[model samples]
Target chain A: MARDTAREPVKTGPDYLEVRLGIYRGMVRVRYFEKRAYDLFLQNLVKGTSHLAIGQEAIAAGVAAALRPDDYVFATYRGHAHAMLRGAPMVAVMAELLGRENGLMGGKGGSMHLTYTEGNFMGSYAIVGAHLPIANGAAWSALYRGTDQVAVAFFGDGATNIGAFHEALNLAATWKLPVVFVCENNLYMEYTPIRKVTAVERPAADRASAYGLPPVLVDGNDADMVFETATRAVGLARGGGGPSLIEAVTYRHGGHSRADPGKYRPDAEVAEWLAKDPIPRYKERLLDEGVAAEVLERIEAEAAAEVDQATEQAKAAAPAHPGGLEREVFSDGGATWRR
Target chain B: MTYREAVAAGLAQEMARDPSVVLIGEDVGAAGGVFKATAGLLEKFGARRVKDTPISEQAIIGAAMGAAMTGLRPVAELMFADFVSVCHDLVANQVAKARYMTNGQVSLPLVVRFGNGGGLRFGAQHSQSVESWLMAVPGLKVVVPSTPADVVGLLAAAVRDDDPVMFLEEKALYPTSGEVPEGEHVDELGTARVRRPGKDCSVIALGTMADRALAAAEQLQAEGIDCEVIDLRSLVPLDMTTVAASVAKTGRVFTVEENPRLCGWGAEVASIICEECFYDLDAPVRRITTPHVPLPAADSLEDAAIPSAERVAAAIREGLG
Candidate 1:
């Protein structure tokens, strides 16, 4: 019950509010960065497709909190949060979205292919459910190497129906691979509502039982809830509990990408979810539980400055040298080279 | 040693030498592989080293990538070259792109061994020389050895390399015998070897066609029309220097392959020779290859579809003319 309490816990005393502020700061960082990224896209500062993780900051902040620095994280196109949470330099990610050379993937991958090997973030894929099998492959390596590392694969509700989703889950279950298949079910797959696609009432979590794997549903809007649930799941995985699927019921506040303004969703539906905005809900919970007003403001001011600095640095980052395109296509040991 | 035994020897010696090297494929373990090239590997290295996997080519390749990325060397067999389409994304995209996409931070020390090309009555699905398709994809090192020694040597080299190598063993060459080294050996990927030396003309051949070229060389020697034969040990990093040098000396060229002529590996070879050795040529470059059509299912029709030693000799004669 204490672990599930709304009040933020501290190691030393009630004044040790820095820990709680850090979580809020991370969520705010992601939130503001995504919001600015969308604005930049409108003005053509960012190029190509951009999957804004606007309302899903809590999911990333919470899930990342449950992971060790060396644990693996694989994500889909809606992956800005996952990249940020996995310890990728915010400037590099932001610059990458802007097609800068200093970006994580050297401006080659644009937004969908962010990679941070040092952070153990394998990579993000644009193809629906394409990285699921790749995540399983990484998990299998972890198991093979006898490391206690666990791999977390993040995908959207639409990916649940892909062949790779079922095959990868089955293989992971069979091998008892230490993996967490996190389905960030935002209730809509692009424009099609999940309810229309499947007769199941609950979520993708309900189908996990079919694979003989445990599944859980949580309030993806609440950072604390997402963190606590993810902690349990990750702990179970590290303890050799085998594979499990966690369905986080969040909502994407922005369009699927910059191209679409989500015209299909009814105005009432947007109003309903916006009323329960994740950041405000968590902020309210923090304040109600007696988080000092000054501490909260300082957190916001610091996060805003950090996001602004990242954006400026991203804008200033140079484009990758033209010659870099010809390099890294193959090993130099006389392999095939496509001219 | 037989071609099959030479390949088996390469796997045996490599697995015996490196504890981290493993052979994972559809029937590579207890079944000694579908072509029996892995015969006795399971008994020698045990199941851990010689692993048999499910029919999932994706899993086979993905597992190989996993193992290769994590310091283990994996030799994955696709059973037959025709099924490479099933794992095309894995081989062409994942394995090939791993090194580059990771910015050379990682090397896929993975070898894909499969019996390629249709000369036998293996039918359409089972018989195909898809080497050109793979050759079209960058970041993949393709080695199609023509003899027992080359098979053993190139495979050993592929296993030791840090790049992803496609070791294409022709289905028809499994029983073809030639002298292989008694011990371990490694061969370079891009270097071509002249199996037979002459001066009348140069015949560039690959895979099974190399053997046919060598046989044609012997036949041409008897008729006083000496022909030089260059075996292209690898397709991707093709030994263009040897080809050019030989073509420059002879002033004539003939490219041979089992794949269809249109956009075939032969076309690539011919283009390279023409670009590099056109001044040295006394006649236009000629190609002795299968017509641009899917291989026929019947044995006689299939034989007609692929280039033979006689066809290659005739092409050389025409180049000389």
Candidate 2:
């Protein structure tokens, strides 16, 4: 099947350069945060399991850079990057991962369920394909309330086969809802290559025609390309053009999770993707475009320092109190079910 | 008013009062639902609010959760209670845990209503009493209304409340008629109502079984066994205070359950009663429940599987003796 590359022309002006720099900075911040989380996991500071987006930072950064502050974003469990890019405090996200009191959800929700409603980063759903319909619902609410606030759902290539995926796309199309379905096609779903299990070659884009949506395919490693695609998609949605399906082609730099060594893929394939890593490649492009090296270095240094401070704060914070276990089960501020 | 009409009435009252309240389901709009309980809702609320979704339970429930999370108060109807299994993830993992897992940052003020239980003989797949399934889930408030008045009143309360409520309308009782209070009528959740007050024994039941328990109490009254029938309107908030109070007064208790015996709502009630009213009991807490088996399609087999009025009365008499 033919894949449609993002057609929004990249402007070459100071303003556009600033936007590119901002996207690059966003990606750098996410990259630093994820690396710090990986180190914390190794040191046993982060409990349970955490899904990292080490190589997939460009998609979150670019898509989020294109969205307005009030627009909703629903991401999958591998969502540290998405949360940070949407302006969730770095300290809170780090603390949440460490199960500390100052965590995003006061340590109630751990790594997989990061939610910062104040930032409009709706949630990071662990269940695959479940949030697609939910994103549609938020978009429906926006449409109902006469707001231009479009909703965006971010998932991996694996979610395309699930029943909720098809149901949500069709419903969004039928209702003409303002939402964008961004599939970070990371080539693999968990341990297996998505191609082996999925029927189609392009997991998300190939299935777009069935829902009457144009198949959108973008090079996920290129922040500029992702930004342009997302800008058009978000604009179209806000303009009442209904939903868009964009399959961002990328690869995870590490294993599916912390436990796996990612030995399933051929060494040659891993090296190929590593060579095309989005961060270094984008930084080199910015340098070639006559941007000062100090500008890029400053961004990287700031991001690293911010992540370091967050790590220290999270490590020093106390664990969530046990007495609050029976709270927030209902809206009444208590878990009481009886008189 | 009939229980079926009250379904529409309760929805109309809430939708009229709150603009955020919307209805979505399969055939819930122009078709008036498969059970015709939602008739005239589309004409009254218009297509914008009264949405007839495709035959997709996941989408229906997922959309409802999303809407509730944001601003809208959505009421989603699944044609049959058994269909909840198809979209159980949305209810159990997503909607039920969203508010808790998010630390109350997201509150899902939504309601999912379904036609529950066996009497229509729709076979194993269609005729299931699934309040027990939902009540086991922590974040959900499970409501099973026994009469038309309770249907209208409880539904109003469920819609108004800021939580996810699983509203189970007994399929067999949809045609049953009773007087409903005029105008805006709302009842509190987590409260039990005593249909018949007596001192000999307390008979506890849910949904359709409440009527059956009342009938059995009438039969036991004739036999000089004055029974108190308590209808548990909501299962999540088990209303153990009322149940324990009744058990204390009667000194003997019997639970008439339509669900399979194992881990039914009655089991929870029985355990609580034993714990709270251990000294007040004159007899062992007898549970009059259906044998643990799948409901058959045949009328007689279905009738035998679910505790009938005769079966309940006979169990009460045997236990008392």
User: How far does residue A97 in candidate 1 sit from its true spot (Å)?
Assistant: 2.1
Q: Cα miss at B187, model 2 (Å)?
A: 0.6
lDDT of 2 by residue, A6-117 (tens): 2343587787898899999999999899999999999999989999998998899889878899999999999999988888999999999999999999888999999989
Report the C-alpha lDDT of model 2 over B130-240, residue by residue, as the tens digit: 988998888999999999999999999999999999999999999999999998999999999999899999999999999999998888888899999999999977798
Q: After superposition, how far is residue A254 of candidate 2 from its true place, in Å?
A: 0.3
Q: Cα-based RMSD of the predictions, in order? A: 3.8, 2.2
CAPRI tier for the interface of model 2 = high
Runs off by more than 4 Å, candidate 1: A1-23, A194-206, A333-339
Give me candidate 2's TM-score against the actual structure: 0.98
Going through the candidates in order, their DockQ values are 0.36, 0.83
lDDT digits (tens) for residues A1-339 of candidate 1: 312322232335554355456668778888888988887888898988989888887888888877788788888888888888788888988888887777777776778777787898877777677666667666766766678788898999988877667767776777677788888888888888988897676556878987897668988888877877777777767777777788888888978888888989999989988987888888887899888778888878887898898899988878866766777766673334422
Q: DockQ for candidate 1, please give it.
A: 0.36
